[model samples]
Target: MKEEKMRFPLSPKANPQAVITGEHYRFTVLTPKLIRLEYAENGMFEDRATQTVLNRAFPVPAFRKLENDVSLEIITEAFHLHYLKKGPFSPNALFIEVKSNFTNYKNRGRRLADLANEF
Candidate 1:
C-alpha cells in the first residue's frame, strides 16, 4: 500500500502552567470543570492532540494544587480533587468533589482505576 498525504495534521497544545506532573502521572486543568488525567508507565506523556482530542488549547483555569508526601490535592472554583500518590488509581486513591449550590457530587475512581491498568 502507498502512503497518502494527510489532510489535517495534529497540532500540540503545550500549556505548562495548566499542568501538574509527577513521575508517572500528569494532570492538566483544561477548564474550571474539565481536567485531563494521563498516566504513562514509561514516563512519557503525550503532548499533541490525538484523534479523540482535536483541540486542547484551552485557557488555563484558576486552580490551586497542594502536594504532600502521600497525596495530591487540587482546588478549583467548580470542584476539589484529591489524589493518592501511590502506585495506580484506586477507589481510595482518587476522588472528586463537585462544588455547587444545589448538590454535592462525589466521584470515586472506578473508571479511572481501569484506565491506569490499560497502560
Candidate 2:
C-alpha cells in the first residue's frame, strides 16, 4: 500500500498551517510536534489575540447571498484545524475542531481554540 504524505500549508517544518486561498488567512501551530495547518474560508477572520474576534465578511456571494467569511479554529496539541463557515449563530459554522492532543490544554491553563483564535 502507498503511504499518503500530507501537504503542510507552508514548510511543514516552519509554518505548516500557512495556507492561503487568495487573500484569506491561515493559522500556524506554535507547538512543537504534531504540527499541522488549515485555511479559513474567505471573509472570516477572528482576531481573538487581544480580546475580540473580528469577522471579515464581504462580496455577499451575489447569488447565494453569502455575506460572511470563514474562520480557522486551531486546537492545540490536536494537530488539526476546523473550517468554520460564515454565519451568525451557526452551530455548524465551527470550521475545524481538531483534538491533536487527546488531552485538552487545561493542563497549560489555556485552550487550543484560544491559540487558533490568536493566529
Candidate 3:
C-alpha cells in the first residue's frame, strides 16, 4: 500500500489576531505566540525584535506588515505563518481532532476510566 500524509488548512483570515482557533489549538508541532507586539510612534510595524522573545517562548508569530512606508502607512495589523516540526510520531494511523478550549488539554487522563460498573 502507498503512504499518504494529510494536510490541514491553515488560513491567515481564520484568526486575524492569532487567537489560536479551531485547528490551531491542537498544535503539537505548531503553536502561536507573539512575534511583533511593539509599534512605532506613528503606529507603524517596526523593529522585529520579537524574534528574541519567540526564541524564549518556543513558538511565536510572524506579521504581514503593510507593503508601504511604516511612517506613512497605518499598518492595519495582521498575522503570518510558518511550518514548524515538533516531534516524530509513527506514520501508522492518522487521527485529527477539533477543539476550542486549549486549557482543558491536561484532563485527557480520565478519558476511559469506566468508573461505575454497569452490571
Candidate 4:
C-alpha cells in the first residue's frame, strides 16, 4: 500500500482593513451591501475564502478613500465607488453609486470590465 498524493487547501487570507488595490483592480469589502470585484490581467490576486466563502471575519466597514492623480473614490456604508487610476476598464472608467434608494434608483452604471472579456 503505497500511493498518496492529495494536497488541495488554500486560504490566503485577505482583510487588510477590507482590501482595495489597483494595477489591474482588486476590491473586497465583503459587507455593508457586499462588495468584491477583481480583475487581474497579470497582477496575481486571489485571497482564497472561496467555495461560497464560509467566512472571512468581516466587520471593518466604514470606508472612504478619495485619491488624486487621475481618480479613485470609494465611500462605503452602501457604495459610491468610482475608479480610473490610469484607465483601461471603460464605461468612463468605472462606476458604482447606490446609496440606499435614491428617489427611485437611477444612477445605474456598473460595467465592471466584461466587455466581451476585455483584452
Which residue pairs in candidate 1 collide? none
How far out, in Å, is residue 66 in model 2?
A: 21
The lDDT per prediction is: 0.76, 0.35, 0.25, 0.71
Q: Rank the candidates by lDDT, best first.
A: 1, 4, 2, 3
Index of the highest-lDDT prediction: 1
> Model 4 RMSD to the real structure?
13.9
| Predicted candidate 3 versus true structure: per-residue lDDT over 44-119, tens digit per residue | 3322223333222223344232222111111112322221112111111111222333575642232111311211
Q: Encode model 4's per-residue lDDT on 15-113: one tens digit a residue.
A: 788888878887788777777777778879876667776566677788888877666778877878787756555566677787886586566444534
Q: Is candidate 2 or candidate 3 better by TM-score?
A: 2
Runs in model 3 with CA error above 4 Å? Answer: 17-32, 36-119
TM-score of each: 0.72, 0.24, 0.17, 0.29
- The runs of at least 3 residues in candidate 4 whose Cα sits more than 4 Å from the true structure, single-residue gaps closed, are 1-15, 26-59, 62-77, 80-87, 109-119
Instruction: List, residue by residue over 17-93, the lDDT tens digit for candidate 2.
Output: 32232244444344423322333455465333222212222111111111224444444444334444333323343
Q: Provide the clashing-pair count of each candidate structure.
A: 0, 15, 0, 0
Candidate 4: lDDT of 28? 80
Worst 10 residues of 3 by lDDT: 67-76
What RMSD, rounded to one decimal, does every model reach? 7.3, 15.5, 20.1, 13.9
